[model samples]
Structure formats: structure tokens, C-alpha cells
Target: MSIKSEPHAGNLCNLQDRVAVVTGSSRGIGFEIARVLASQGCNIVLNGVSNESAIEAAAETLRQDYGVDVLCCFGDVSDASVTADMAKAVFKKFKRLDVLVNNAGILDDGLLGMMTQDQINRTLDINVKGPINTMQAFSRLLARSPSGSIINISSIIGREGNRGQVVYGASKAAVIGATYSAAKELAAQNIRVNSIAPGYIKTDMISAVPEDTHQERLDSIAMKRIGQAEDVARTALFLASDLSLYVTGQVIGVDGGMLI
Candidate 1:
């Protein structure tokens, strides 16, 4: 199941006729972002490390539900060549790009003193270099779009830092840094870039944490509850659409007031 370049239905406001590429969207937060964007009338390009079939299924659901175009590309975004290929595939179908959400990332938990080189490299490659490479590959189309936007997914640990996640935190922190610099450089071309730092979201990524550990995290949030995928999805939609036109180069935490 793949979406055609042109939408098969009428356009809507905010994201009408816009095209958005969401990496790591097979499930979890990325999937929700694609869903919300499709509902807003944006054509979607879906990407993930593996699971081509799953991505295709998700795309098909979006197509059926929203009457919008949806394309699925499978590959490891951490690889520069793969990211370039993903961009090319997207342009081949859509002909133009309006928004990009670099949401693909991996986590490796270990004490800093005991972390291995492979863990460090893999975490940084997927969580940090992936966005940089994707942005570079897609900048041309974005520069020409009417509403060019780039939204990078960071984490609260990136800003506040955390134990047993030094490398992962570092990678997310790097994402914020890239967002700041890219926003400054791309603003002239009408390409808005920003980062979202989420905390303790109930995703597969955090399921490994013990119940007590998770509770501890929830207790710290001012909202006194965990955030849902929709929370981050809403934030992504804002940055991807005109709602955040005057906002860029900023790290907005979607952590239920956890950062506050």
C-alpha cells in the first residue's frame, strides 16, 4: 500500500496539500505523529529501521482513514547513504517536501564507566547523525516548499542528564544542538527547525524500566502523570504547521510539566 503523489481527496486547512516525512513512524510516537498529520490533510512519507510491512500497513491505514497520500520507505536512517536514498524516494513520489520530522532514534543503557564503544557509536549514529544526514539530504526540497519545517525529537534527559543513559542523553543533547544551528541556517529559506524534548513517555522504548522506576519518574512531573503519544504528536503538528511559524531553534519539552 503506497500513496500517490497527489491526494485523492479534498485538502484541509493548516496542512492542506502539504507533504511531511516522518522517520521511525512504524509505531509509537512516530506513528501518532503521522496519524495527526494525515488527519490535518498532509501527505505522509513513512520511514523506519526495518519492518517494511508494518510501515506499509500503517501508511495504508492513514490513506484509508484520511484520504491522503502515504508512502513507506524502509532503511536504517543512521546510515548517511540510507538517509539520502530515503529522501530521493520521497521526492520521487511527492515531487516536493514541506515538512520533515527526524524522530528515529535508539537507546543504549549502561553506566558511563562500563559502556562499550559499540553502544556509544550505535546510539549516537541513530539518535544524532541520523537527523543531520536526513536534514542535509532533504534541505533542497524543504527550501523550496511553501511551509518548510524540520522537527527533531530530543529527550528531557538530554537537558537534565540522567544516570545509566549517559550516551543516549548525549545523543539527544546533540539533537538539540543541531536543531539550534539548523534553525539559524535554514530560517532565511523559510525552513523552520525546532526540537521537542519529551520526558517519560509510555512507549516501548521505556517499557524496560521497572514499575517502581517509572513511578519515580511520574512523581517528578508536575502533572503527576505520564505523557501520552498524542502529547508529542500535538507538539510535532504545531511545529510542522504554521502554528509555530514564529518559533524556531527552541527545545519545547512535552513532558507534562516535568521539566518545569
Candidate 2:
């Protein structure tokens, strides 16, 4: 005898009419997260850098598929002026921001000794400083919401170090630190801050991993499989919505028990 599941009447998180900004959402995990948020009744602000056409197309897809209000703001999150402009654009159109997903990041892996200054700086700027800039620019708008949420996209490598990923790990580790501190500081204003530590996800980033190394990483997982973009997207949705109202300063892993 099989049990039947019932369909819910309303949206998952009461996020109807809310506004969310998802950085680097032109494609891949960030785009999936934005789509998930939009499906749950949240208006979305899709952000990307150096790809106006792609970003606009992503926004259009979300608008057409989910029928939710969609806006495109193209800029590098690491730039203060750009982030400020993004914030202004959001406020101008939506008047308030409910969710901020710091998903824009870069990964440049190499032996510490072989890594160049340019590689180090670029990685840190995009991965570490990018979130800092966005949070600073959008925190004011987030504070205005009754259930403001900030979701930082970190990685399991940040928690458990990986070879040749020292610089990348450091950047993500800093994100975790920022999430913890921001949660404490923003709690006074009814805002929640959390980080998602994804592990061995099957995205473009993972595709670039050497074949043998990828297999080794897969074997390390208890589930013995790579994760999907939707895995992280679902976690982001939880943090962005009121489902995680009391959850803050926590590093939730969507890593198929890899950390265990």
C-alpha cells in the first residue's frame, strides 16, 4: 500500500511579493537559486558581470516561467560603486529588499608557491570582498524588511581544507566569519545571516576538476556522488524564506554527507 502525498494550497514560505537579489545568476547554481526563489513567489533581481545579454535573458526566462517581477542588475559585486548602484536600482524598482544571496565568487587553484599575486588578489577580491561590499550596500534595505535574510554561498573546502585550494579556501573561510559576525550584528534589526557550504557540486566549477581527482572526491562522499545545482538552490531558498526565521550564523552543508 502506497501513501499519497497532499498538495499544499499556498506558497512554501509566504514570500509572495518579496524581492531578492541573487549575484552571478546568469547561469549555473546562482541562476538555479534565482529560479527557485522566483517559483516561491519572490520577485528576483538577477545580477551578473560582463554579460548584459545573458543576464537579461536570464531575467526574461524567470519572468516568463514564474510570472514574477524580474530585474537585471549587471555589475561586479566587489566594486563599491557597482554594488551601490545595484542597491539603488533595487530600491528604485521594488522599494525594499527582502533577500540578498552573495553567490558571486571566483576560484583560482594552484600550489601556494606557484600562485601569482594577480591570482591571489583577484580571487580574494571576488570571493571575499564581493560579499562584504554587497552586504554593506544592501543591509540597509534588508533591515527594512520584517524578515530580512542574507545567504552567503560558501564551500566545504572552506571548512575542511583542500590541496591547491588554499587561497580559495581562505576566501570562503572569511565568508563564514563574515556570516557569523553579520548574524550577530544584524539580529538587532531582525535580519538573519547564514552561509551554505556546498561540497563537490556538479557545476561548471566542478567540471573543471581533473578526472582522477574528481573521482577521488566522489569516492570520499558517503553518498558516492556529486551534488546538483538544485541542492544548493533548495538550501538557499530555505535561508531566504521565513522557513529559516530563527536560523542564523549557521553553516549548513548541502554536501551529501561529505563533511561527515
Candidate 3:
């Protein structure tokens, strides 16, 4: 891990030939983030729990479009053994990992009293424990890079109270806590840990909202528009590359002023 400072201009080199793992990257925000990194000359390891064919296609698309190596790691990130296997595969293929995007998460919206035990457990496992498992598995590999970046995808609801999202929001808030502690623990190794709290991003979830509810959401945003996945992806690009070497332990809002 390199601690030597470099000007932002020098970040122009971008992550040429670097390797990144983006979980749940078969579609939506995760895929966009992977594509953004690939566009920057970074090789990608696309991870997904199900949808094996979609994951493979996404990896192939990256390889064809960006002309960078892409591998598929299929498993639930909450399983430590799965992440361990993922680390082994990465070592065998790329032999190094420079960036880790913990983008695999799920939402189970229900009031605290109405939520089923299964829903709560699954959300916590995927949204909270998933990042923990992957970070632990890949920390050693990441440390070997010039500098490593860990980008955890949280949500604006995590930073604020949202009705019907109590459990899910708590899970995301836990990720921010993890980022703070991880940044401190990994700083000495030149590994930066941070969280991206996106607000009302354009994704499948947003697409499913009722038309009236959707309009209400748009009205609440200061920007008066929904955020695009690219908006978050570009921010991820900054964090994944040397551009954010000096930035860590932070929660960047790609929320279109929704939080402010």
C-alpha cells in the first residue's frame, strides 16, 4: 500500500490493469459501478448470489466492451466460506485486488411489528454481514495493492428515519459504522474504507414505486429529480481510484441534495 501523496492530476492514470470486485453486479447500480470501473481500465470480478447466466453475461460484456479481464464469482456474500473461495479465485486469477465494492444488499420494507423474523434475518445477513465477510476475506489481498479502496453502498434512509424501512435502514446504518471502524483499522495499510449513501437512485426498486408515491418522492428531493445510477457510479469511480487516496472514513452523498 502506497502512502506517498500524488496530485489529483496524477490520478488521471486511473486504475489501469487494476482489479475490482463488485458484488451483485449483474444489473442496476452494481452493474453500473462495475462498468464505470471497467471504463477506467480496471479489470472486474462480477459477483452475484443467483442469476448465474446474468452474471456471466455481465462479465463477458465488460471484457468485450472494455477489453479488460472479467471474472464471475457466484455466491452469497454473507457466507464467509463463499467469500473465502472468492478470495482464492481472485488470487489464482488476478493475484491482487485493488478495489472492493460491497454493493450486494436487499430491502425488506415493513413496520417493526409486522416484519417477519425471516425478513429481518435475511436483510441483516445480506446487507450487514455480507460486507463484513467480503472485507475480511479480501483485506489481505487488498493490502498488496498500491492503495486499496473499499466502497460500501449504503442508503440515505440509513442516515435518517424512514417509515416502513426501520430494519433495512438499520442494516445500512450499520455499514456506515463498519466503514468508520474499518477506515481506522486499515489506514496504516493504505487501504481506505468509505460508504456511499445514495438517495432515490434510478433502479428496479424505484421503478416499482406507485406513481403517486414516486411523484411525492421527487417533490421531496431538493434537486427535484431522481438520481441516475451513473451519478453513484461516478462517485464510486472517484473512491475506487487513486483520486480519493486521501479521502476515507467518509459518507459521500450522491443524493442530489436530498439529504441536505
Candidate 4:
């Protein structure tokens, strides 16, 4: 038996006509994904909460740099009605949504014993329910497109469990669970759903950890280095494009062998 090697180069504009909505994309990992998609000619609907000015600035940059249409929707994905509104705005502006990147998530770290109901609800509402609600609102629109994808950004904590992140882990775990079930349900419509479980990606999210504590977290990674936002963005681009057309329902780890 002969092994096959993946092709090294291809045209990068395969997503020229696709339209995408990337939640919490004003900065960090989400922003990087938006940039990656836009670079490939995908129209973008940039999402964020309390970052209207930043969102507009990012959107303008995408339009100027990539010459693609970019619309900014400011809202909290955790709110059901707002999630629906975000979808509506996209449809109204772009008339199609080929990609939905559920990247809006909040992390509240605390031992289970000290975690409050408010903390648990806040984490779950955004990390888990936000994606679900967003998908529900736009599934029909996605189905209308010939090729569609839903990318749920989960975490390694969801799979292996992490101390001091009981509630946060629960929310991410739910994202992984939904990824499998939703992909199965939406496959017949030719719409794919997948989740990306990133290990120690260096984003603003990591700022929550103190400097010394962050160093310890980095030491635990087998790669001996943390990943950048572009690392996850490149993965999102692969899943969003036709390159991974046959892949679905998979929880891909962009985690430098951390799961091992």
C-alpha cells in the first residue's frame, strides 16, 4: 500500500462567492479567522458586543484590503433575540450566508465549590447556547447555499477537563456534543458542522491568567510554545473552504499534541 501526500499548493480564492458571519470577531482569534476568510474573497459579517467602533474599523480594513463586502453586527450572541437579529442583518445585507463561525465565548474560572449560579449561566449562555441559537436562526439560510459550514470554536478543557474551569468546561463540552449531533442532522442538506478544540492558543483570552501562571500553562504544552491566533484562523479557513468538503462533525484539535 502506498501512502498519499496532501497537495502543497492550490488557488486560495476558492471561497470567492461565499458569505460568512464570524461572531466575536472584532479582535483576537475570531478577528484572525475573519481576516483569513476575507483574504480568500469571502464576504464577511463581523460580530461583536460593545465594540461598535472597533468592529467598524476591522470591517473597513477587510473591505479596503480584500475588496470584499463587510458588514458589522453589534450584539451579544448570548441573547436569543439578538442572535436572531444578527442572522437577519446578514441575510438582509448579503442575501446569503455560506459560513457561520461561532467564536463568541466567555471564560470564568473558578473551582466548582466556589462557582456561582450567575457564573455558570453566563458561561453556558454564551459558549454553548449562543452557537445553538445562532445556528437555529440561520440554518435555513445556510441550507439555501450550495456549500455551507458551521464552525464551533471549542476548547481542550472541554475534552480533557480542566481544574478551576468547571463551568467553562461544561459549556465547551456542550459545543463538542452539539457539533456531532448537528452535523449528523444537517448533512442531508449538504451543510457541514464541525468544532475546533484549540489547546493553548495565545489570544486575549489567555490574559485572564497571571504572567507566572501563564508560563506554567505554557510549560504543560508538548509543543513548548503557545499557538497564535493565525494558527486557529488557518484551521477555520480550511474547514470553511471547499478543501474540507468531505469532512464533517469532526472535532479537530489545533492543540499541538496537548490532547495526547
Query: Would you list the C-alpha lDDT of every candidate in the order shown?
Result: 0.90, 0.92, 0.93, 0.90
Q: What residue runs in model 1 are displaced by over 4 Å at the alpha carbon?
A: 1-13
Worst 10 residues of 4 by lDDT: 5-14
Question: Taking the tens digit of each residue's C-alpha lDDT, what string does model 1 give over 142-166?
Answer: 9989779999999999999998889
Q: Against the hidden true structure, what lDDT does model 1 obtain?
A: 0.90
What are the root-mean-square deviations of the candidates from the true structure over C-alphas?
6.7, 3.6, 3.5, 2.6
lDDT per residue (tens digit) for residues 1-260 in model 3 = 97997566536537888999999999999999999999989999999999999999888899899999999999999999999999999999999999999999997799868999999999999999999999999999999998899999999988985999999999999999999999999999999999999999999876679999888888889988999999999999989987777999999988888842
Better of 2 and 3 by lDDT: 3
Indicate the residue-level lDDT of 124 in model 2.
Answer: 94
- Checking candidate 4 for backbone clashes, the offending pairs are none
**Per-residue lDDT value at 46 in model 1:** 92
TM-score of 1: 0.93
Once fitted onto the true fold, the runs of candidate 4 whose alpha carbons sit more than 4 angstroms away are: 1-9
Report the C-alpha displacement of residue 59, candidate 1, in angstroms. Answer: 0.8
lDDT value, residue 78 of candidate 3? 95
The model with the greater TM-score, 3 or 4, is 3
Measured with C-alpha atoms, the lDDT of residue 139 in candidate 1 is 91
| Clash count list over all predictions | 0, 0, 0, 0
lDDT of 2 by residue, 52-153 (tens): 999889889989998999989888898999999999999999999999999999878999799999999999999999999999999999999999999999
Report the CA-based lDDT of candidate 4 relative to the real structure. Answer: 0.90
- Model 1: ten consecutive residues of lowest lDDT: 5-14
